[model samples]
Target: MAGHGDSFVDCGCSVVGQAGGEAAATAQRRVLARTASVCPVCLGPAPAERVAVGDAVLLVKRCPEHGEFSAPVWRGEPAFTGWVRPKIPTARRGPGTERALGCPNDCGLCPDHGQHTCTLLIEVTQRCNLRCPVCFASAGQGGGRAKGLEGLGGELGGRPGDERHEGDTRASRREDDPTLGELVARLAVLRPRAGDANIQLSGGEPTLRDDLPQLITAVRGLGYPFVQLNTNGLRLAREKGYAARLAAAGLDSVFLQFDGPDDAATARLRGLPLHADKVRAVEACAAAGLGVVLVCTVARGVNDHCLGDIVRFGLARVPVVRGAHFQPVSFFGRYEGFGAPSGASESAPGVATAGTDDRADDRKLDDLREAARITLPEVMRAVRDQTGGLIPLAHLHPPGCEHAQCSFSGTFMAHEDGRLEPAGGACCGTGGSGGAARDAGTGGMAPEPIPAALGAERARSFVRRQWRAPDPATVSADTDGARGGTLATPPRDDFERFLARAGRRFSVSGMAFQDAWTLDTERLRGCCIHVAAPDGRMVPFCAWNLTSVDGRPLHRNGAPSRTGVAGCGGLGSGEGAGA
Candidate 1:
């Protein structure tokens, strides 16, 4: 078994017993645990097992109709079993819907859920400005809704009562952009249910809306404390004072879609060269006193190798560039040629890359899919390896709000000398009882259960305090001097210097969203980030985005109804929000 500090490698671990002629490989494997999953082909519930082989863990499941599926969930260092953060399951209070179905099928935040909402995403529109090859929401112009009858119930599968009448015309079923009045009504209904959970305004591209500032104002007016916009910075870079207008509207931060450090990385992932626009957007946000978090969609052989460069770039911007968040690509919405076995090219122009050409063979394609995945452990190791251990594996801890395996995050203090030192606090730990010695394979000791509600609250508070830009009034003059600006008077003492440096906190984190291929019911049940559906139910983020291999959605464009709330008629008539 390898340790966290070991040199990063593919390890080439495969699913041994998943297919015939691999009987010899099964002898070296071990079953670690059992859980529930959904078939990637049929979207039906399937019993699954976590199998450990070499230093990796693969999620293996067999659908009665769709056969077997396996994908790597963890790889390389920090050991899968040891990375545990146990939370006492929070009882679902005031559930939005009754459990007519089970687990994911009954995902209106049914009583079976194990965690509370930390961030509630509201997709404002489905119309996007750019066409990225790897979009989870599959956003587009003219709306991404299907044509004619295909756009209704059968293709866009949903729970009961989500079906539209056959006589409904294409004009009637059109996924229109929600009006300001409709959004306000929906928010009013969700306010009592969501409490103070952070609000993220997302869409095809949120900046596309001219009345975006008004929407932000409405969110703030409704008493939500923090509101962040999810966008690609094209508009902010092209239009002067755009960021300032958003700031004036009471927006706290910008979740900028920043793929990598250079244009080549952007071109490969996002269809065109966008590095310059991303930089200008950051500058605009900085000028407007708005905090920005650089979000990178990490795809294998694309931007995964540049994680270190992205972090270094964010650090150079300091308080304005508050954090860097990485998301490993999941095959759900518009990934045309993501995991295709060799020779298949991505649908986006010039965005194509190498993949296995085994599409004709189902077993071979499954093997390729397993090979293409870049798991959470792999991402943690990449950060450490690419940054030359500046962000050590020990410093990165499992999440407190979401499932332990879903993400990892750490905060570092950036000093004038360009060193990133770990700002260890309650969030940093092996999450175990006492100071027990870590096991050889698992990175830490068995975790002791903490209150799930406490974890959710703590995560919400941390993001609110750390993700926002440091107040200009409290920033010491020495801080400006550190960034090459002149200081009227240098820090008088070491304490002042320490205070100045402490104010420059930079966060590094990565989240692995489960796709149909990797949908773990246990993880889904414990999800903290949720989406606010038009029908007034808070659906977990993954559940809202989950799609089968054929591209039929489980919840996206779900039929909207007005039964739950008062005064909000014609709700769910339009498309929901996304990022």
Candidate 2:
């Protein structure tokens, strides 16, 4: 593996010490694009550039006081320049806040932000039942003040008097879970601002709250069409009727934390052997007619080898398991013992230990870090390799809704005999008369380029239809609507035949989140996932979870105080709610 700034010649020789000093090494690098990022040490805005070195693309930035920092953003196959889906930047309908500070710092969905809310995450609580070592929110713990905002006070984007004093009541208030009335008020404020965005009730573990059924009912009552739960699945597995109760309460989908097929992977990542419990949870969801999407946190050298197995497991479950979603591990929140350097005892359990070498320098340490970090292209190739071409590289397409670099998705129709056929319109080619090209999956003409706004709207509809449990009434109407159970008019065409088995559709997608080391303000501005803040504002997902190297948050615990805006008050002081 190559380090962050390492460069080499075609003949594979190191060119760092050949006598031209620093300028010689700098000449070998090719600058790709200029953007803005924040320093991992200080959380201050800095100018950054994407540069290609060897086969990797690194995001390199320098803070005047903190010096230079570099991290690999893309590496190997599918080529960075070729994996682009250009979008006509569409701003939000009504700006939530003024542009006071800058891009990420002024994130009240300021007028300059370039995307609408595809999914609005409302964290119902900051408490959890399990203490997983890889939590992004650092949940199930108490930390009143935002460490990243310490001392800077109002200068860091809050109002003049918004700074917290030593004995302020807000600090203690941070520990209390929001009451039901408070959540209803928050939903009323969000219903107008978010306008038709999908709702996800996230938490330390949302199941920990006894009123979760009530919360789901409340969300649906406010006219949000879809409601999903992000959970670990312990309660759903152990409590017999829990899944049915949630389904009856108007819940549509379950984003279950299912790491892999067996205990070997779960014990290493989740601190216990939970494969059996996860299976039972899925079965329970199936029994209750609730659709489930298996969510896996892909960590390099740990569960990276388990992607194919996870996909196979989901496929075996068919309509009950709607999809498999993989997320590359980002260095933030609670990933303490996982990414340590070579020879450290704090390495995650069951991982192979590296031999001790006192001669390891900063560059060698950086190589280890880069090796631990996995890129989106690498994951795509891994899926191709691990699944033996069941999912080919050509079938996977750049996301139509988000920045092309953020994700890749493919839809497949599963057969009863365990074969997957790529559905048409999976790829979003460039849009216009000239944009039509050959469809890689079917050798036919492909769909034209999709505008960003239209792409987002279609994506929301697709998720609602595919990820929700099949409606019994609609299924009966399609399969047995005729008298005496005969087809009304036989099958007209192959397209109608395909629609007959629509319940078998399955999706495979991966999302690469940005951490302090990988944050690119360009990608941040195009983000479609937004978090609804207690202060009656919407913040982009990445900006809300941005934290320094030492776990100090930028916006999670430090949102501005709530104003007297109608239906926006009384949201409790709990911090960092969503996954």
Candidate 3:
């Protein structure tokens, strides 16, 4: 829609003649890019347009049968246009499998993909100890099915290879859990195929597996350079020796879910009041010499207000707290709005109710409503406001690995006294349309711009260093033959020298993933974070979790419908689901 007399268009007619023609000079929301999107109603491809809607941006699309739809893709100052840091698109490395269907459906990293894999997530199990109401994977203790590496391979198409089990045991395996041997076989295939991929061991809760240490050891044996565990931190808090055990097993880092600073916020997002447990978990990892990154799920009017506090807390922990990743809540499995009526309780602001038809398709353009949560830009502003302008919005690096609008990050040097000094300076792009704060002097200090050629490598290096947890027991020994020949450790004196050259650095990052409503195929093409599927396919993260408006999954697990999508079925244990 153009600003030419459309009902949705407003040229700021009231102030057009003011501000020495500044208002008159400004253009109304206009189309920026044409791309492919999915119809939230039918889950089919739709013609979409990325429009500069004032200071924010929105993705609008129309389905032949489902009418027009729109969703906010960017918000706040540093206009959407400014955040883009374009790079040369890489040529696809041949489709690993036949193109079964276009895009999303044929997610075998089909030769059409525009980005290379950076992080490969392997879901070890579908079972989770805590069932949060806003689960993207809808994981639980009793409902979902589970699969091992071999079974996962079958889902993709066929097993990687017909290799027999080597040194396997029944005690280490559960009904739905994968045997250590099966997992090793699966990774063995992925190791060389993905090429120097960073692996994250994920599950309902990776801590649930008793053989988790052995699993980590196997992945390390696969020669994966970096290995991380995604967990809720319950076990780490309760079991004083758990962190040390993981460190011994060669696990490099922990992606701990820390929603907010208060118990009320935690109860609202997670199922229980877990502030104390979260704190204890971080302390445990610190004592065990494990690095921790706090992963926060920001819900509007829920824990969104706690953004700055979370950053401060993360920085206060310094070398131990490596980073804070904020993810705005996206509607998918188990979402009923932040304060909507359900079993979970907290003194929320209010309840959000749809029309009489609770399951009405919200994808229609006429029915579009504002999401009830903070966005990436809002979080960036919060960081500036709460931190006394020490870290302004520009401090965040523009998108590099993912789509320009998908996320933002900033790296900083941390001191023991809790002072955070910007390490790489302001490393973000400015929306072509000038922003309110573009000339605000960025807290009176000029930012050092990161060169385009060095941006990606610099960002990757920082993430690698910040997220790695040094294990004293192993140092840098080659535990298995898979470790690329040999692993080397720096001497204590050498380590001190490295620390002096580059003090402890931490990243403050935010990723706003797309849900079915906002699944943009153009953005999908540039996704670098992928999940390893059983059939030897590498699926993009958002596409893997995408569910129809009615709750039928397009990839991985079959989910029950909230609006009655056909073929939807109950998820059972071992389904290999993830959040």
> Over the stretch 1-579, how does candidate 1's per-residue lDDT look in tens digits?
111122111125754445543564666579999897876654556678888887888787765554566677888677787677888899765747765445576677888888988898998876666656567776653222222222211122223542322211111111577888888788878887788888999976777677899999999999988999998888898889989999999999999999998998777667668799999899888888888999998888778899999999988888778889999888776664454312132221111123333222333334444545799878888998999989877777787778888888888888768898877642422233211124333444565677888888888888887787766643457555223122356567887666556558899988999987788889998898888887778889998887665444566655322231112232211122110
lDDT value, residue 469 of candidate 1: 74
Runs of candidate 1 with Cα error greater than 4 angstroms are 1-12, 15-24, 142-175, 339-371, 426-447, 478-499, 559-579
TM-score of candidate 3 on Cα atoms, chains taken together: 0.75
Whole-model alpha-carbon lDDT for candidate 2: 0.67
TM-score of each: 0.82, 0.79, 0.75
When sorted by lDDT, best at the front, the candidate numbers are: 1, 2, 3
TM-score pick, better of 1 and 2: 1
lDDT score, candidate 3, position 469? 50
Of the two candidates 1 and 2, the one with more favorable lDDT, higher being better, is: 1
Q: What's model 2's lDDT at 531?
A: 85
Show pairs that collide, candidate 1.
Answer: 82-442, 123-577, 123-578, 124-577, 341-355, 341-356, 341-357, 342-355, 342-356, 342-357
On TM-score, the stronger of 1 and 3 is 1
- Tens-place lDDT per residue, model 3, 64-178, is 5545665677666666655655655564454464443455655667766766666788878765656565676655432212221122112111124411112111111246776
Worst 10 residues of 2 by lDDT: 570-579
